[model samples]
Target chain A: MAEKVIAGFTVNVTEEGYLTDKTQWNKEIAAEIAQELGIEELTNAHWNVIDFLQKDYAETGKLPTIRRMKKEGGISTKDLYDLFPEGPLVKAAKIAGLSKPASCV
Target chain B: MKKLLILGAGTAGTMMANHLNKKLDLKEWSITIVDQEPQHYYQPGFLFIPFEIYSERDVVKEKKQFFPKSVEYIQAPIKLIEAEQNLVILQDNTRINYDLLIIATGCKIAPDEIDGLEDGWRKNIFDFYTFDGSVALRNKLREWEGGKMVLHLAEMPIKCPVAPLEFLFLADWFFNVKGIRKNVEITYVTPLSGAFTKPRASAVLGNLFETKNINIVPNFNVSHVEAEDNKLISLDGKEVEYDLLVTIPTNMGDQLIERSGLGDELNFVPTDKHTLQSKAYENIFVIGDATDIPASKAGSVAHFEAEILTENILSYIHGKPLEAHFDGHANCYIESGYNKAFLIDFNYDVEPVEGTFPLPGVGPFSLLKETTINHWGKMAFRHIYWYMLLKGIPIPTVPPHMKTSGKKL
Candidate 1:
């Protein structure tokens, strides 16, 4: 197991730096992690994506795919890409305090 | 009596041996096949290894298992092909003369071409092209949590051009299965401007990349790998950082082809795209990854080429003009994760369009659209490759020619 201190909170991670424990995540932690990842501020629009990803993942134990987000999360394709420059699912899932979603890419 | 020699006992060579053995008279013609590897690897199965969908045992078999008993097998690495003298020189200094030759020595992944790739290979950077590489990568992925996972293609004309995208898809599935999906950032970097080489398929696959949240770094002509810094630098001074990198390196034809001075700049035999015959040598035929044809470097293309080459070879032996022409036909299964896959069938003239395959509007398989049946077909092809294809038995209804009966424009 690996560990990282993000926003002054110690979290267990995988060797590749994925959060091993999802329960340690919170909005403040997400904000700090987002800031570390180079996102200056978390807008409501970003939170809308993050909150939906978090709740959906908790409920289903799966990260909703980009298609699923577009269908159910009510976010347009353009907005989703805008929220996360190169990795929308990656960044959104991180801010939502969850691990990555499995295959389709 | 005449001797027909085949180089390499891979997909193309093995199939050619079976096809010719049945067609030629044993009393009149003797056939010999040479290859370095003792085992026949089902190349497509390499994709399933890292995902744990396949094991090494599933992909490997004794090369002799497929060769007909009458055909002589020489287990030796080729040193050179003395094309001028119609002879092949083996590494052991033995020579074999032939009246007709078929070059099927397939392409190989050349990692050393990119600076710093050899230093990080199998440590942080890995490829699935080799059996050992796939097994090593599988072990790595088993323990890896995920962070900035990048799947890259060093250049085009690699075997199964769609495979890199498939790996990205399967990685998504693999991480999700491990419950670390949020931790992995999947990105696809390619030399091509789009997701695939073909336009329509590129658009569809590109959309899938976006929908799957797999980032695309297009037009990335990789100049080198900075393993210590965890960056891939392109020729134009761009850099992409990665925690784990899975790449298909620059693919080149057999070195023996280069040593013999029989190949082009990349060591690929210059082949007549329509005839499957070597442009430089009249009596020599080229198949599969060995040929510098515009067709996709795929098993299906080799199978299709073998059919035409079979007829052409028979004509050449009889002192008749070769009438058969290859259409650069290719078909492949694109696994989109989950239980669905897409099937595409095309020729030199046609691109993969949406429709049913092998039938007009009544296919058991769908083309250019994802379906569970296509996934089953893709899985089922392993059996077909071993039993029907390598045996030279023509698959019913799946003709060598690309038909437009079921395709939608």
Candidate 2:
């Protein structure tokens, strides 16, 4: 589903106003999540990961594995990008709005 | 020339109505479902309400919205189930007869069951088992700055046993968002030994508590709460004080179950584990929270039970032997805050072992472990619950049974 682009920006909160919009996906939080993961803003590299994760899933389908993600990025060698210090799974999954895997916790 | 009467229009009743509505010949068999409440609630979403992830609109819809058009819905409160005469009395003292009765009357959270619960409920203490309560708790949480918050389960056999844990997990995420996670000391108090019932599950969940830094006060049997003083007194005489209390009170089956002389002390119908037939009356059957089945009182249990119950009900009608095959299979997603979740799949005999699910070794989703895949799977379930499960339409690939195909031993 396309992100809801509602009317006005009601005081786009920064790190200082953490309590402002915790449960929702705002531009600021998304940006923070993106920045923490070193994902370049609005690039095909970033959008590709986001779009693939957005599809409906079943038990049979394969997850976007590290190898697959690397191949899809059109990189010469699959480099494990050190995005967030707290594990790629946690940082990538959180930004993707996926559930915290039991193994990850 | 027998009629089937189903009580309650909640998840269990709705599933039974839909399942039987399609199978039974409408020309010969008449099916009527009775429920006092006019609306149906997406109960799982209630867990997300306090985090403001879900407004009331996201979790609630009309009861008639889900009921099959073929089944007759009686919007009246049941007074009693007169089993001997095979008739049920309405609150107005009107009676309707039935040859076969399917008791789908689900459980209710009786906060009043616990001492001091009724007095401080919804004001100082709140439960998310209901829509109104969830909304109130959400407002309370939003206004909160920081304090000692106690998330409690008054007793077991409550609808959705995993909800309270989900609350704590989300609270960790919620408090972090508010920059007050460290400020708000969250303590989860449950009657069970660990964070959950099964030892393995509790261990997995217990580890999560350590990771989140949420305090776990296990085996603290609550004697009563002192809301005025903002304290909980356990049976063992341990007192844990809280500034804000989130409680899942003692849940009981519908009062009509007791009124009918068909239920046990808790108003839960005494049912045969495999048959789902009421022990007291062979012609009567019970499912969902209404039955005293030794299973997790969750929606998936009800779904699995409905599948077996439908086959049994039909078999009984045709003078065939009832299939004693329901394995108490249940699956739940534990939402650990910070956008992570865990999934568990188990049946009556099997413990929740760590492994991948549905497809076993090649799962897109993992089981008994935290992963983003499980988190998305949990969110995806909301859509599945509305579109497939309640409508008696099974998910394309997932079977009713807890298959070991993809699960690691």
User: How well is each residue in B159-261 modelled by candidate 2, as lDDT tens digits?
Assistant: 8777777888899999999898878999998755457545566656667788888898875657788878889987546799988888888888888887778
- The weakest ten consecutive residues by lDDT in model 2 chain A span A56-65
TM-scores of the candidates in the order shown = 0.79, 0.78
lDDT of each: 0.84, 0.75
Q: What DockQ values do the models have?
A: 0.01, 0.01
Model 1 per-residue lDDT tens digits across residues B103-140: 99999999977899988899999999999999999999
